[model samples]
Target chain A: MTRPDRAAIIGIGYSDISRNSGTGPGTLIARAARAAILDSGVAKEDIDGVVGVYGSDSPTVWPGYVVDSLGLPNVTWWDTAQPPSIVGLSSAAQAVLAGNCEYAVFYHGKYRWGSTSIASKGDPLRESPAHEMDPTFSNPLVSHAGSLNWAARVMRHHMDRHGSTREDFGKIAINNRTHALTNPRALFRTPIKMGDYLAAPMIDEPMSLLDMDAPVDGAMAVVVTSLERALDGPHTPVVIEAFGSGLPIGSEGNLWPEADGLAARRAVASLFGRTDYSPTDMDLAYPYDGFTILTMLWLEALFTEEGGGPELLRDAWSEDEQVLKLFGRMPMCTSGGNLSEGRATQGFGSVLEAVQQLRGTAGDRQIGGSLNTAVITNGMAATNRSTILSVS
Target chain B: MAHTRRNYDTQPYWEGCDQRELRIARCADCHTWIHFPRGVCPNCWSDDVRHEAVAGDGQVVTFSRPRVPDGAPPMVTALVALDAADGVRVLGRLEGAEPDAIRVGMPVSLDWHEEDGQLVPQFVPSGGAPA
Candidate 1:
């Protein structure tokens, strides 16, 4: 069968990210959806589909709720999926391509107290459910199965096997902070130096406070439609060149760094297979910095072979500018990423930033040369989702 | 602090811990040892899996020293790759070594400790430090 027309992201919108929004997730979702609809200049009546991501951590913001909130009367397709909005983006793109809907809105919202935010402990209204132990890995003597603990182990493992140092991880933190300085939407904009990263309190050994993403309450949404139809829209449409997801076979419960990298590698390889653009052809890249170590693994998966990420990172750092320019030209996470962007989980923040850069609207963080192609990767280990976007 | 919760698939492993044994699931058909036990064998999809005790010899793949909030001593946790279980790793607290002294790939042997009247598996340095 001949391939269908590619879908394109026509507009992007997001609410301000903060430690506390003093609003429920449903309100945040509606605000973002309205902003995205207004930004796209697409009439509310023209929208035919809606897609949103909801997780156990965030209050449910189903697509039906979005349609009702936005008063989209002609909606024929709507569905809610899991978090990391890429999954929803992919679904919207597919629906548009198949002619199921002419225009679809994809959204994801995060609540600070819904996650493991320290600030949540103080608010009685934000009290989350009791933590239940994972029966498979839990022991009565140790409580160390959480994601932070897993990242700590992965960082140590990467250092042990690849001869990378804490400074290498520090470079990622500094690079993000430097970019975040220009991002008005970023939560932590103050620049951090290598010393600050190294001196930061260690939450879990090897993974310092700066190594993790800041949890915040916010929401992001994007309007996706067929590339052909998007050409008539107001903004420059960023085409979804290709999208793919992958998981390593027989990798159930395998938290090893090697296995984690393999999953990303598989996803990226599948992604590249569907597109003409190789890793070197991209003008910018966002490899998901939910943790510093994840960015390291993603860099390796995208550019080099295994055990090569640290060296690539080391070379990407520019001491003269105190910023990271991959291979001395291409920039990563110009929107500050999750590290500084207040953890807009599921790669939504990256996608939004990529769209901005491709449209030459990233303000001071924009790349100098002609920016055409970009890659956005989300999730890790078991659920790896990737997409290649371009303004060709 | 009590952490282990018994489920139908993992009850046998907890029972083995009570007997001072480290048990993992082994497929009756493919003989593939599985950690984080599920009812069926992931490798072969065989429901004829049995919980069996192993020698509990392993090496630390990696470790972390997480800070405690209540001014308690830092906890050192390690992920161990079991010797007999192919491609199986387990998380446990590491004892008998200081945080500064701990290193990746250090030889460790499993030991059981009592937590709230329940036996929980842990690891300690064995065969001296790596040269």
Candidate 2:
């Protein structure tokens, strides 16, 4: 691969988050794009590229719709990536680095609580494994097992293989809720103790209600520009130091039953191998927490120096605040994560929060000291992408 | 029809379920088993893939009984790793035992259950057919 020109996120913006946006998807997309463009202090005409995440409910060609709505000049480069906002972000960065475009804006918009539930009303299942697992399928056991059930099966296997308990999972939920208390944007600001986590209604056995991420209607956007241009921009530029995306060793034939935290280790190796920094260098890290088990899996995968296991997770949640905030130790999910902060646009929520921390704009939830670098994992399973970012 | 949305690749798999036989794609080149019914062999990337019948006996890798509303009784839902098809796990209902009695690695044989006007693949204790 040719060495691409360096790129950095110059600005990040988000719409008012809530259970219901009470607006159309197009409105949300336009609102977020405008906010990001304004925040970057870059002219709208300069945004030559517009990339977005395309889910079933989203338009087949999102950039065309967004550009028209925002009244921006015809972008030289534009495309929509399916799911896993990482693909969209990577596309935008590639356009910028290749000089196809100067300023690029990547936005994710979803209406989970709108009048029409997007999951039920979106495009029909088309050639995806997730479709075969639907309840109407001839497989009764998995018919009922949606993503939650699959994650539960993985969690059970993790317990059987590595001696992780339900309480160990509970500790992760508790820690996320604890962190959410300071985040006003968080949906579940009310404190949840170990009792609450254990006693909460079970969605899938081994995965209680608390372990799942609450879906909300919201949008988030990030502006990517050349590193040289970012230096002249408004906020601290979170430079993309290194990135890698791929499937893990065990994710091949089946998804959940045989799945393990090692699914992304290969990608993790490539990510850390390319960068000068190790996992120890990150002052903050955001592991994809679509499910709490996912967060634990990412923590174990990237932080192998500290030994990747559930025991480490249990200790991290149990440790004192000073130790939690220490450089080399547990610096994960500081924005309360998906579990508490509301699952805002899938992977973009975590990336948005990491950028905030690196820019010293995280407000009440900011980590102390000179925060230089952060690591973030976007997507899951075969579509995973891990990125390292820093303020240089 | 139990499933009205199946495409060409998946329709036959569901049809095999109706016949009370467990069929999975096998690589004609390497004999590697593929679950979830795909076009090519994941192991070898071989295009010589054909759906073949197998002894549907497998061990329960993991099981769950989600507390949700449905017509069927609270049956043990398990991810079964087939004996004939190593590393190929399929999700099916575990029958002929209490939900709480099921354990990981326990032997289970292929079976079928009818619900929502569809015949679905299920598993029962290997000792005998599901009663």
Candidate 3:
């Protein structure tokens, strides 16, 4: 990896977004980029790479075009992927490693609400996985049973094996929203109790609304540069110690009845192999929760620490009787993940949260300790994309 | 389960249902074979590749029989790593997949259907049949 000392996130930026980009894409992208440039503490002239991806019906406004309109320097590279913010990050990493550019800018802003509805119309079966379980395939076409339902099935099996429940699952959302109370950006600021979660509307038989992440119209951007370049920027820089991505191979034979290990484990191993850091090394948890059960499944997949779901719930949510009994540690979703807080136009908000925590700029939602290690699992499909970031 | 019209992308493979034959792609670059789809090999990462028909004589690297059926007529599927190529693998419907008969490294050959314009791929025990 002779890629110029690689890259580290030096600054982060996000736009004030909501259900409707009442303001539209132009306004949202501008705001998100401005936040990124200012946060990076480096001049706007420094960003040479802008990568992004979007799935929408509106007119295509490529990231490079957005970069040009911003009156910033010429972009050496630009790319996009579906809703997974980390996909953009992955592309950015390749661009950095391939020596395509030095300072990079990644952002996405879209009307996430309408995207789902429009998406469902196309090859309805193609997008149906998000809404219902395809019993025809014996796999979920959509819903908790949808998409990566196999991962949840794995979690359910583990829970029964380890003695856990929907209530234990509630600890994750409960603790996340508790953190959201202080985040003005959070759309669902209404502090929730575990009971409140258990009572929420059910999406799948066992997964409830609280378990699934709510969608919002927001865009976030992150600035990355060489380690030497980072120190010269606004704040002390945190490097991306490792980022690993796994392509969906569907090796389980049956997506319905999963046996032994989950497919993403193969991918998780790839990332850990790169940096050799485990879950215990990270002080804060940023498990991707496109759906609630995924958070539980991810905790077990990380294997950076011991214990699975109940233990994870207990570690992050101490006040709850269910979690306390399991003996878990490491705070989860302190900025109120995509669930309690609102999901943004682009998925980059998760990575942006790590920057906030690392820079101690997380405002009222500030996590207690100076976050040294942060693990972010960012993809949503059966495919798992994850990265472990640390203060070097 | 609804006889949901299967997506045409895989009709070639499923069409091989009645007569057993397994379909795969052979690349022009390294004279190696592969499956799924590719103008190139994922292993060699080359675009200089061609699709050549071959007899699906492969060994079962690993397989799982679904107790209950899933997709098409509830049958077992196996990941076949072919002997013809290095590191080339494909998933195919298994025929005569008796619990006792199936074993890792079991020798199998292609038997398939050429339906609706596709060289659909399927598998049967080696020497039992060939397409």
Residue pairs with colliding backbones in model 1 are A84-A346
Kindly list the per-residue Cα lDDT of model 2 for residues A1-392, writing each as its tens digit.
34556989997877666654443344456667777887999876677677888765442324544554454553445556887778888888886785545688998866542224555334332322232133112232346332235777777776777777777777677777777788776788887777887899887787778888887988878888899999998888889887754333334223454433554555566678667788777878777777777776777777753225566765565444521332335467777788876777576667878898889998988888888888888656534667888986
lDDT tens per residue, model 3, B28-87? 666655433323243343445454445668986545443332353434455566776655
> How much of the real interface does each model capture, measured as fnat?
0.29, 0.22, 0.00
Best by TM-score: 1
DockQ each:
0.18, 0.19, 0.04
Worst 10 residues of 1 chain A by lDDT: A132-141
Top candidate by DockQ:
2
Q: A248, model 1: CA deviation in Å?
A: 1.4
The true-versus-predicted C-alpha distance at residue B5 of model 2, in Å, is 3.1
Candidate order (DockQ): 2, 1, 3
TM per prediction = 0.74, 0.72, 0.51
lDDT by residue (B6-122, candidate 1, tens digit) is 434456777888899988878899897856554445444454768888887888888878887787766787888888787777778887776788888888898877766777778
**CAPRI classification of candidate 2:** incorrect
Instruction: Name the best candidate (by lDDT).
Output: 1
lDDT for A42 (candidate 1): 94
Least lDDT summed over 10 consecutive residues: which range in candidate 2 chain A? Answer: A128-137
Clashing pairs in 2: A248-A263
Candidate 2: where are CA atoms >4 Å away?
A1-148, A248-256, A305-307, A319-329, B2-4, B43-46, B70-72, B128-131
